[model samples]
Target chain A: MLDFTGIEKERLRARWVSSAEAPEFVEEVNAFIDTLKELGPSPLKAAVEAKKEEQKEAPA
Target chain B: MIETIKQHVAGLLTEKKIAGFLGLIEKNGHVAPHLFKDGESLAGFTLGDRKTAGDARYPLNKTLVTLSRAYPEETFGVLVRGCDERGLYGLFRLNQLTEDRVIPVGFSCPAELSEACECRKPYPDSLVAGEKTESSQLKKVAEMDGKDLARRFDFWTAQFVKCVKCYGCRDVCPMCFCKECSLECEDLVAKGDLPVEVPVFHLTRAMHMADRCVDCGLCDEACPSDIPLRLLYKKTAQIMDTDYGFTSGLNKNERSPLSQMGPAK
Candidate 1:
């Protein structure tokens, strides 16, 4: 799992990339897509199930 | 601000650069977002104080998303304040817009707005005019963090009770691009009452905000009930920060945690 701490430290680097740099933007985004290849599918099932149980326990 | 924006607007249109520009226009002493076509009369184009609008939420973000989808081939420029710029970034991440098709005319908001909205960066990467200033806004999330759990619950409950169900919150949100909303989901939130009962409606909105909300405060402004929806979403953002250490709309390259899974390879 990726450490959550490093995420905020990452700077939002934005420049005035022109239409001519469209290819560069595409390449950069595509490269970013490759980095997240290992995180796999969302782990929301457990979270959602726990939430439902908690909701059931709490008075509605 | 309006005079400078007008000159820029006139220049862009005269150059035949963009099909239309989106910005606030003074309408009956209230500021509302309007699509300004190149040749249209410019009399109505003026920026007004957001506070006097009564309805704090500016629908510019929603307008851009809708227009971008409707006219994909045409180029559109928008006068984006910091919040609007973040909203645009969120829309871009969702594939609602491409970088080349939209021009973000950054306008540095006054300190009052930045403080009121608790804004971090009051400038965009590319700006047309105005100097960036230090933000004086208090982070509501930080304030809420000081409160006890019971107090937080009571605070939100009382706020939610005022909702008029105007749907202006969702309607004005730049990130709320979905045709069908979870708030309208039959299984989750009930639809009849104004200011939905307790956790269902607001919590549902909060859950959806996990990695989605950009903290624009437009939702809070749009709410007729004056609910601090931004605080709840900010809390959710803070939680995401705990596990994922990420915030929304700051990075154009980062894929939202909710939309994608795995490492940042």
Candidate 2:
């Protein structure tokens, strides 16, 4: 069921890499990259268009 | 004006009436808000040409409001401007602050500051400083209001896109009193993003500001991106003035149009 209360586990971005061939850091970095891929491109294009139009008429 | 303020404080303290006097204190070339007591230190109490470290409006207002909330039974004095007075008035309308507990020391803003702020009134309901001056109507509000919706959207979106999410604007806003701000809501504003989305981040703040914004222009200054935030809030205030024929901080009895609507008696 979808949590209606909107409480989600705290998503943290932290990494500790020890000297000499840290496989864990590389794995975590790769995982973060995969998450970014899942999220896909942001939806800022339409909003950017809207904002440009407003500036044309504002006072200098 | 300084002497006048001191005299008033002296009287209030002599009568043991007010708990504190909230006004400007110049220490080391900085004029920030300070709470003055009877016998502590009045030497630093000098007021003139306040060099704003990103809108002193919010800091001063926050001090008074916090003091009032902490000490409910005590009365306090507040130095106010057209913007500060209007913000307080808006707060009063919203039932955020009590007028009875606040003594207003009104001052007229200089021409440069007035023009920069585009203030409608440089004086408050009460006066203790310089003479009253004419109100300045910011041309930007009307200009923006006349724009087509798409153009308006574009302009504001670009402005919001540059937002650093520093919360300086919210932090410096004297009228912003929400202990839990909607901007901080992970769902609405999103978390861990530098400049969250356009309408989502800024638009939410603007909507919340609606009838509550006092056109202090502090938010604009506090914003590192220099987003024309004052123009947006100014627009909101204009809508309130036009639609309801009400302005903040002028009257003690009028309720803020946002939470509760009261007849303009």
Candidate 3:
């Protein structure tokens, strides 16, 4: 669905980690974070920031 | 066609086959859903035709859900297009209405109506009247699929921005029988906000509808935002069909794959 909405397929990741394997979970998280860093912030960030700015600028 | 339906419904009503026939009525040049308690009231019955036949549609199944709840003992006959029969199958699965308590009086859509709706199935399994037409391909959805991701994003963003948060789509949907709606949840969606979390709001709805959507197109017509919601749901339905090997709202025995508590295949 994210792919359908133009978000890069790399933006979201899923992995099954056992609760007993803390080290494996850490490794998976680190790997996903590295991938995200390479992808940079989502394009939706700028649009959301702009919306917040517009809301702030509006008279209370 | 209307005459045949009236006679059939009349026979059902008189024979105690149905407690009432739930169908659209034309009164004072206006069309609305009404329950005919007996054959004599057939004078006001219509095929929901106005300027065009098979227009002036209503979510009669939603009404049926309420009616069934009030009088669980009674059986009812209702007007059914292909989409509506699909909804009945869905409703039965959801436990909103039982198959035994409802009888369908099926009719096929006019060619123009079928074309306009881009209906996949324009007629039910059987029709009491009107010739069956071929199913329509989702032309708009196909067009959207051919676009690059960037163009798709921009198109959807602009469409979602027009939302006034009226919730007309949910209200008008027969499948939307949930007492508590996730859309209205304050945590998921911030209240008192215009253009509410554009992607999240609609995506949530699309995800929820993936398993349940009957491809009725009522949501598209009800949208005050004029969002092509049916197209979105249709796209999701395609994914559900191709990936999970399930076409939604088809059989009473089949449960939505998502509804089953198990690991994805």
How much does each candidate deviate from the true structure in C-alpha RMSD? 12.8, 13.5, 3.0
For B137-179, candidate 1 gives per-residue lDDT tens digits of 4466667767665455445555555566777888777788777
lDDT of 3 by residue, B1-265 (tens): 8888888888889999999999999899999999999645688888878888666889999999999999999999999998899899888888899899999999998888888888878888757887888887778877887999888877777667667799999999998989999999998998989777868898899999998899888899899768888878988998998888787776556788888887655
Give the chain B TM-score achieved by candidate 1: 0.88
Q: Is candidate 1 or candidate 2 better by TM-score?
A: 2
The TM-score of candidate 2 is: 0.75
Looking at model 2, residue B110 earns an lDDT score of 71
Docking class for candidate 3 = acceptable
**Every candidate's lDDT:** 0.68, 0.70, 0.85
Number of the candidate with higher TM-score, 1 or 3: 3
Tally clashes: model 1.
8
- Model 1 lDDT tens row, A1-60: 011111111122344567889898888776655555543443333433454455457624
lDDT of 2 by residue, B1-265 (tens): 6677777776776776777888878778767788888776567775545564223443577788888889988888877777778778777766778878887777777776777777788777777767777778769877765666546655665667667789999988888898899988887767887557755576578778876777777788788878888877776667678777766655656666665666543
